[model samples]
Target chain A: MLDNMSLSRHISGQFNAELESIRTHVLAMGGLVEQQLTDALKAMHKQDVDLARRVIKDDHKVNAMEVAIDEACTRIIAKRQPTASDLRLVIAIIKTITDLERIGDVAESIAKVALENFTNKQYNLLVSLEALGQHAARMLHEVLDAFARMDVKAAIRVYQEDDRIDREYEAIIRQLMTYMMEDPRSIPNVLQVMWSARSIERVGDRCQNICEYIIYFVKGKDIRHTSPQEMEIFMDNNR
Target chain B: MLDNMSLSRHISGQFNAELESIRTHVLAMGGLVEQQLTDALKAMHKQDVDLARRVIKDDHKVNAMEVAIDEACTRIIAKRQPTASDLRLVIAIIKTITDLERIGDVAESIAKVALENFTNKQYNLLVSLEALGQHAARMLHEVLDAFARMDVKAAIRVYQEDDRIDREYEAIIRQLMTYMMEDPRSIPNVLQVMWSARSIERVGDRCQNICEYIIYFVKGKDIRHTSPQEMEIFMDNNR
Candidate 1:
């Protein structure tokens, strides 16, 4: 018969494997979402309706991945009954996938803007939007990297990056407003661009949310709704 | 010593009490969020800056409640190690609080719109927005009622209500676009109104999400991302 120690070790090993599998799956989902965002941005820049439509079609894949990962996490919780850091990791994964799924939705929405007709001047307005989308995509990429490493420092850096994304979004909004005022006839098209910009801006916020989940998983602190100064002080004091 | 049956019953009783407490707290949080949405709508219609400011300030209370309830749920999961339906309930509460917190944020943002100076014409535009906000608030109220009852049929009904909310939102958008095209100088103010309308529309989506959570808790099905027809058929077949 197996000894108690051996049996416990075997169970622990199996639990760790389960956790590792979900982690890998989450990173894979993140990569797919990032690809969606990047492809959607390309579709907008190139006016590739086919690519945009593909992005929309692929969103179901992202949603499927979320549901799958969520089930795995739930199973782990029910079977392993993880406590302390282990439990926090499962909870964070659950929340993080929700945010990733939302980013995919945002990407799909941005791609829809590509299907709308735009004059050349209006297409010019998309240049700023492309810049903003690129910024958000980079944030998503770096945040996923931070997530993979579970690096609190890297998460904080990505969290701070949202401010730059916000500034870029504000600049685009101002430009769109000016464009609308200059040629009132372009209001409809410009409004579409504005909505796309708004959607991209939300991606930054969603990425920041994922970063908070990373920190929460690592530090076991719920750092959401905290001001930047407060977060910094908490990190400094804890470190 | 107590028998195994009595000891198990004792533990189950305590677990039930813990679950019940969190459920009560969630309903309380839902009530606060509903109040915030209603007051924000009132603030917009009446141009009441003080009420808007109060809504913004009171948002932190909503955030604090979410954190507290989340901590409690995490503790229950760690201690009780709830299985099956119990596990789903805890998980649903975790996701539900996140959605409720977001609705609070939407309320806060809409209230900020009241702080902006609006011309009489812009104020007239807010009448349609008021109608939309009221519709969203009702959905929220009914969804919370569904959540409290754990009624899948009620949840499905509330989920269906979101389509009407979407239609109302689209109509408001069309009105705003026409108004903006007529008076280009009103672009900035109209954009703010448009954003407020968008935020209120999101509350409908968030409520629908809560309804999904309620159904998931009761039926153990993940109904997210499903079309209305698919959802209806699933409900009918399950019934």
Candidate 2:
């Protein structure tokens, strides 16, 4: 017969494996979302209807992954009744996937904008949007990396990066407004471009949210809505 | 000395009380969010800067409630180890509060728009926006009521209501674009109005998300991303 300690260890080992599996699934989902955002941005820049349609179609895959991962997390909670850090990990995963799924929605919307016709003059706005999209995509990638490592410091860094994305978004909006004024005929198309830019900027905010989840998981403290200085102070004191 | 049955009953009763308390708290948070949206709309329509500021300031209360409710849910999971339907209730509450918190953010952003200077011509757009805002607010209030009752049918009705909000949003966007084209000088103010309308419309989507959570809790099925026809069939067959 197994000794009491060995049996307990075996159960814990199994639980650890389960947790690791879910974490792996989350990363896989994140990778797919990142790929979607990248391709959506590319499709917009290149005006590739085929690529845009593919992004829109593949959104269902992202949704399925979210539902699957969410179910897995719920099952783990019911079965393992994880406490403390383990429980936080599960909760964080649940919230992270919700954000990731929404990011996938944003990608699909951006792709839809790509299918709309843009005049030659409106092309400049797309270039600015491409820059903002790339930045948001990079933030997403880094935030996911932080999530993978459960790195609070890295999460904080990603959270700070969102400000630059916001600035870029504002600049693009100003440019779009100017374009609309110069050529009122371009208003409809510029408006579409504006909406696309807004969606891409929201991706940055979503990444910041993921960063907050990472910090909550690691630090066991909710830092949401806290100012940057406060977050830094909390980190320093906790360290 | 208590019998086994009595002891189990006592423990279950206490667990039920705890769940009830958290559910009440969720409703309270929902009420606050609804109030915030209503006040934000009123402020925008009446151009009440003081009221708008109040809404912005009161947002922290919503954030605090979310953090507190989230912590309580986590604590219950650790302490009670609730299973089956009890577990689903807790998970649903967790997800619902997240959506509620986001709706609260939407309210704050809308209030901020109220503080912006709008030309006389832009006032008409605000009237259209007020109609959309009222529709979204009603949807939020009704969804919260359905949540309180755990009424799947009511939830589904609110889910259907979101289509109307989307159409209203599209209509407002078209109007705003025309205004921008006609009076390029009004572009800046019109754009602000456009953003506010978009945010208010998102409140409807958030309510729809809450409706999905209610169904998930009641029916124990994940129906996200499913077509309305599929949802109806699932509800019908399950009934």
Report the C-alpha displacement of residue B107, candidate 1, in angstroms. Answer: 0.8
Residue pair clashes in candidate 2: none
User: Interface RMSD in Å per candidate, to 1 decimal?
Assistant: 0.6, 0.7
Tens-digit per-residue lDDT, A49-70, candidate 2: 9999999999999999999999
Candidate 1 residue-wise lDDT, B23-54, digit = tens: 89999999999999999999989999999999
Tens-digit lDDT string for candidate 1 (A80-160): 899887898899999999999999999899889988888898899887787898899999999999888787788888888
Q: lDDT (CA) for every model shown?
A: 0.89, 0.88
Shift in Å, residue A46, candidate 1: 0.9
The superposed Cα distance between candidate 2 and the true structure at residue B36, in angstroms, equals 0.9
Any runs in candidate 2 off by more than 4 Å, and if so which?
A1-12, A235-239, B1-12, B235-239
Worst lDDT 10-window in candidate 1 chain A: A1-10
Q: What interface RMSD, in Å and to 1 decimal, does model 2 have? A: 0.7
Which candidate achieves the best TM-score against the true structure?
1
Give the CA lDDT, 0 to 100, for residue B80 in model 1: 92
